[model samples]
Target: MTKRSSPAKTGPQHLVLLAIDLLDSSLHYPGDHPPFESFHFDIHITSKAEDEKSQVLVTVKIGVHNENITRQLGSLTINCTFTMNNFADVVRLNADGQPDMPDDLIETLHSTALSTARGVMFATFRGTFLHHAILPLIAPGSVTEEKRL
Candidate 1:
């Protein structure tokens, strides 16, 4: 697992969902259909803090793959923008002027965004062959650990 940005840990921050956007989505099948042996998930989380606006934009992408992981069965990318109440406290400007956020805060936001995407993905492929290929319930740390910004 790739490490997340290890910035100074700030106290808890209140967040509200500002918006949810479906950035991209697609579904495919390689002859053999659902009820397959197994399914794999590829989850990626990335965030950008808007200190001036006291908001953070997080994108969570959930991709489903076949048992062997050779072919992609479906994918859903959702971008969620959240308004952080204590933006200044939890966010700090790095040397490069990028907003450095705490791991805990990021992990929480990632988890929420992932859950939202999961529901959307499920509804999207409903009644289709990919219906059975649902995004697995993933730990917050495990999801954000893969990638972060």
Candidate 2:
């Protein structure tokens, strides 16, 4: 008789929230002039678990300005929220149960945006794991705009 071995199981509970932060920078339009200003982005990342269908939610807030006029004629604000699924598939697990990021996942996140809107924005984001035990990431805030052109 021969003995049979079973495959190792990777569960969802092993996932953890690593780092969350925003990259805010202004872009100037036309040589040395702030004609059009734009705020960069915000990102939240989580450690990948064993589930291949696990999803992660990312929320974004943007501020826009049109400096073509002199009296702050107009401004725009945008709020965006998106979900990235199958993130766990981009996580590599070592023998010690540590999570490692895959190149594909980084690429996907770098080029992903949730939604966009115009004029002072506020938003709340949440992520639900299907058939798994995972908590959603939530951010509640109001983005305000004040400019004097």
Candidate 3:
């Protein structure tokens, strides 16, 4: 059965960020093109749980593309590992016997990971052609909708 027992207010105290790693990133500008008139962002999120170790890894990948999206301006991929003190209690097997994660808990992790990527993107793109192109504040619900895993 799906576990819905996790408290809605799963605060930061229950989750500890163990690490943040820049799995990949790239910046490229077609030299002759006019300064990006406008750009779009493509974001992807995925999560893996190691319940035995009370750890969860959330991966956030963002891509910056030109107005037409025919070309990619830049991209960033970040992986965040978090430790939950109540992992066993929070994550439980669903009716299918597959691990089921609480929505609140998943949102929390995705938010944090995305925010971290935003900051890192700013720093990494600083002094570059895409310097002014910053990641906007994303609602967790919108972000979670893109999650594939």
Candidate 4:
């Protein structure tokens, strides 16, 4: 899960005809029990949408570590390519007022891609990561941020 949160969009009246894929994912290490103390994430997209049909390549990299600063606990890298038709309203514009892909919407799609990638990653290390690492992070009845992910 990410440290930051994005408000969920429900009853959406904008955007349609979305398609996404997970292209690649790699894991450096699965980490030990209690997993890593922190993680690192990188996300980006390469777009080609001249006719409003966009093909985007999204990537996500996660580096995991524990209290030990020098050694890395684990890492995950993922790549995805998706095509979608951007709604007129959500599209960002250029200097000349010409329409372009919205960076924010692209970012939102990146999260969706990562979510699928993360699901696969967690399933890959079901015994180690799921049981020893992620499950322990949950502390019930604690006042915390919204639980949506």
Q: Which ten residues in a row have the lowest lDDT in candidate 2?
A: 125-134
| lDDT per residue (tens digit) for residues 90-114 in model 2 | 4445544434444444333323322
lDDT of 1 by residue, 26-53 (tens): 9776775436666788878777766667
Q: 66 in model 1: Cα distance from truth in Å?
A: 0.7
Which TM-score value belongs to model 4? 0.46
lDDT of 2: 0.31
* C-alpha root-mean-square deviation, each candidate: 5.0, 16.1, 3.7, 10.2
User: lDDT per residue, candidate 3, 1-149, as tens digits?
Assistant: 23334333343346899999999999877687666666689999878666566677888899998765477889999999998777666666444444457687778888999899999999999998898778888887787534333
Answer with 2 or 3, whichever has the higher TM-score: 3
Tens digits of lDDT, candidate 4, 1-149: 11112223332243432544444444445334444444433323234333344344445454444454455544545555554443333444344433344445554554555565566556654665322333122222221211122
TM-score of each: 0.80, 0.26, 0.81, 0.46
Q: Give the range of the ten consecutive residues with the poorest summed lDDT in model 4.
A: 140-149
Runs with alpha carbons beyond 4 Å of true place in candidate 1: 1-13, 32-34, 145-149
In Å, residue 47's CA in model 2 sits off its true spot by 10
Stretches of candidate 3 off by over 4 Å are 1-13, 93-99, 145-149
TM-score of candidate 2 on Cα atoms, chains taken together: 0.26
- What's the lDDT for candidate 1? 0.75
Error of 3 at 120 (Å): 1.0
The deviation in Å at residue 96 for candidate 1 is 4.2
Collision count of model 1: 0
